[model samples]
Target: MRVAVVQVGYGDAEPVPERVERVAALVRAQAGHDLVVLPELWAPGGFAYREWQDRAEPVDGPVGQAMSAAARDAGVVLHAGSIIERPGGGEVGPDGHGLWNTSLVYGPDGGLLAAYRKVHRFGFGAGEPKLLDAGEDVVVVDLPLRDGGSVRAGLSTCYDLRFPELYRRQVDAGATLFVVPAAWPAARVRHWTLLAHARAVEDQCVVVACNTAGTHAGTEMGGHSQVVSAAGEALAMAGADEQVLSVDVDLDAVAAWREQFPVLRDRRL
Candidate 1:
């Protein structure tokens, strides 16, 4: 399968709608890709954590609408990164509060295939635990290709990379491709690259990590978007700049590796 990873540049200066439109145009320009992945919180900047309430939209809002259109126009399955969404009032938990950091997956038919909220919230600097609600479920969806094959894709965002158990669960659920959309910072560029490869090797799956470039609210991002194979090989990588990194992934190879090694069969839990 041909996958396009978009390394987006984030800045608080641009309007959210304009940014979404620009990225959608970029995705549309890259024709013939089976899947298009965007960075986390590509619509409203990730650093705008405090302003989430103001910028948050419903799942059927403009951002999701634009993504549906873009996916259909591009003829690719889109992992539309993530956005701050406000769940309907009374749809939330006991507290009655309603908002989530959600990722929406759209098929080539422009239909919603999966919706995943960020399971692990980043709580180091600004402390996300105090701001956003944590998600409870893991999302993995099968994306059908035109050639009569399908890729089992797993959904994750940003800080979720630090947790390997999630990826293991995805692999156990028959995921061959892991997609991580992040806004990782420049201060931890090394960790960003290392962890992605580690997950790919450990899970024996393809890892396509798309991180944002540029700065957002004084925090500069490490824009080394990369695609790693089941053997921990870097198929394609981008520097600290905005660019699209496309790589061909062989789903057959994943099965061959797992069948030869059979490491997953030894799991105790």
Candidate 2:
């Protein structure tokens, strides 16, 4: 499978819709890939937490519409990155709060494939828990590949990378590909790189991490978007700037590695 990881900026300085449109056009231009992944909170800047409630949209709202259109035009599966989502009336929690930090997936036919809310909120700096609620479940979806086999994709957000258990659970659920959309800071670029590879090696799956580039609300982001193989080899990686890194990964490698190592079978839990 051919996968593209996009590393771009998301700052309060630019108009959200216009930026989304521009990136969509860029992704459409590179349409030969089977899956195109974008950075976290590509629609609205992740650091723009103050505007999340006001800028939040429904699942089928304008942003979703735009992504659907782009996915259909590109003729490839698109993981459009994270968005601020407002759940319906009764879907809100007991506190009556109704929003989530969510990621969406669309098929080549412009149909909605999956919606994953970030289960582990990033509380390092600004403390995401103060603004966004945690998700209740994990999302694992299947996408048909051109090779006549299907790949199981797992959804996760920025801070979720710090927690290996999440990826392990997804692997147990049969996910062969792990997708992480992040707004990782420049101060901790090493952590971003190391953790992504660790997750892939530990879980024996292909890991794709797409992160933003520019500064958002005075916080500089490390833009080294990367794709790691099941054997913990870096297949392709971007620099600390805006870029699109694409690489081909054979899904069968995951199975081959798992059979050779068999570490997963020794888990006592």
**Cα lDDT tens digits for candidate 1, 163-249:** 999998998798999999998999999999999999998899999999999898788999999999898899999999899998888
Taken over the whole model, the C-alpha lDDT of each candidate is: 0.87, 0.87
Instruction: Give me the runs in candidate 1 sitting further than 4 Å from their true place.
Output: 94-97
Instruction: Give the CA lDDT, 0 to 100, for residue 107 in model 1.
Output: 88
C-alpha TM-score for every candidate: 0.95, 0.96
Question: 109-220 in candidate 2: lDDT tens per residue?
Answer: 8899999989888875355777777898988999866566779999999999999999888987999999999999999999999999999988888999999998887889
Clash list (residue pairs), candidate 1: none
Clash pairs, candidate 2, are none
TM-score of 2: 0.96
RMSD list, candidates in order: 1.5, 1.5
